[model samples]
Target: MKTALTELVGIRHPVVQTGMGWVAGPRLVSATAEAGGLGILASATMTYDELAAAIKEVKSRTSEPFGVNLRADAEDAARRVELLITEEVRVASFALAPKKDMIARLKDNNVLVVPSVGAARHAEKVAGWGADAVIVQGGEGGGHTGGVATTLLLPSVLDAVDIPVVAAGGFFDGRGLAAALAYGAAGVAMGTRFLLTRESTVPDEIKQAYLARDLNGTVVTRKVDGMPHRVLRTELVDALESAGPVSGLARAARNAAKFRKLTGLSWRSLATEGLRMKRGGDRTWSQVLMAANTPMLLRAGLVEGDRSAGVLASGQVVGLLDDLPAVGDLIETIVADATGILRRLASE
Candidate 1:
């Protein structure tokens, strides 16, 4: 149960509840922290002011340390980092590798930077740039994910970096945690597993939709946000995959406007952020437009409880999950089970 991750973040267990947008909120986050695991508040879906309030809310709920997940490409990344520094947030996890200056600033403020990396090279890059640790998620992870399996990606990242690595994707129970530790990971970070918990703020109906699926129920498609987003294979996703580029762009534009109102960002600023997103890699204008689908589309299902209208991001591990447990019970059971598994393996 005690690993470098626990020591680094001052948590009792090496388990982490990932920052799932629209789901990882104050209640769930505080419960995870109170349960003795690292709970990450998803701030990418919130405005700067909202994030500040959320940090305060989490602090009010639990005295234990927690982290905030940030969007490295957000237009106000620097301002958000400043808030984390001022608020004395314990950990700052990024959806992408943050700029060297940002990483240094957070570390200078005594905040631990833990960027989630999909590839070994990214993990190496962040480690070299002074990240305290890395969460390496593989293809089986929910939402934006790469194509490698965790069994392969975890060791690759571990061998590539000296910093502690937390393995994510397809991890549900104690055996998975034991396997991760056996593979030399400091711990396991789970999204779908945590999202199904009783403390999750996701609506009951939507939670039922997620719980009803088997491993084959999820699909990774670029149609959602011009990225390989792994979501439940719902009719909406099927329509997206079959839709032409014109329809996709139309939906994107509409959602982009909605996002602007929700986040209080000016159109000019939103356009500028889109340009940055385009230049970040191979994202085209249409793909940039599709990016809007993530926040709004996710909000529909996770927050509004409209499963037919919104998308449910999930790990393939959904098939293996059955019931919802409180954050405390979930973490305690996994850690205790993992300890037993490890002991038995050693004795054998």
Candidate 2:
């Protein structure tokens, strides 16, 4: 049904397909947009040029409004922000809290700024900086997540921020949408749920693997890099978790090099970014490197189809999902089910 999120983003449905690197690409984004959901392209894994091309491709595929998730701290973040302005994207989403200047720049260009936050403080900070909205993802969310659960964090953020809040984490169905709405959220933002959909770039074999797991199949561990990351409990994940910080440091060092090569970052620039992360309380150099490797690890599973060697960031909702349906079908089912659930609750 129509909610503030739907009207703000100019989409028919209040649901959102969150940006998952290597998973939420042109195909998935366009499909979700066509399906009446606000799909966001994950720009963390793409170069500035690649992101621009993908945005154009999505525009060609559908005229519906969509968003782009950017690395607010990237070296070329300004360039990427410029691309969004030039493309006239409906919304500009940030993986973390964006700089006040960046937020102002986008708002000046008529782009809606929505940053994903894990805590109430972050929501307040972004709202104070003039963000159009905020997406609050709790501890149960996939990828890099905080320790607060959605049940607690959602209302905390809603109470703290005046802007619209989209509840995320541990949400995979109509029941979740209803729960989020009841919590005073404008809508729900889904990551793992959308990544497991038929339109996602995730391999069929891996998608099947995700479908087979129950709620207990997923685990959150700091072993992946240095930060606590939520991922499937594969054999590799187990090995890494047990390896401890030393091993993680070693891996992070190597991955940092690879990331530099892939993203064309100079050593000076990489070290500067690493230092920024470290100063911001990430602590160790390993944690700094892992921050960048997080996207690459997810790409291994999502784009390359290697579950064993890759880190698959997924929400606990994976256990609740069984089938991979087309984006259109999935959105329709969710909207209809949510409507029915709301009506039933009203009657009660």
The candidate maximizing TM-score is 1
Candidate 2 colliding pairs: none
> Residue 245, candidate 2: how far off, in angstroms?
4.3
Per lDDT, the best of the predicted structures is 1
Per-candidate TM equals 0.98, 0.97
Worst 10 residues of 1 by lDDT: 264-273
Residue-pair clashes per prediction, in order, are: 0, 0
* Number of residue pairs clashing in candidate 1, backbone atoms closer than 3 angstroms, sequence gap of 3 or more or interchain: 0
What C-alpha lDDT does candidate 1 achieve relative to the native structure? Answer: 0.93
| lDDT (Cα, tens digit) per residue for candidate 2, span 194-305 | 9888888789998998999999988998876667788899988889877767777777777777777887767888889889878888467777777666766777787889
Candidate 2: global Cα-lDDT?
0.88
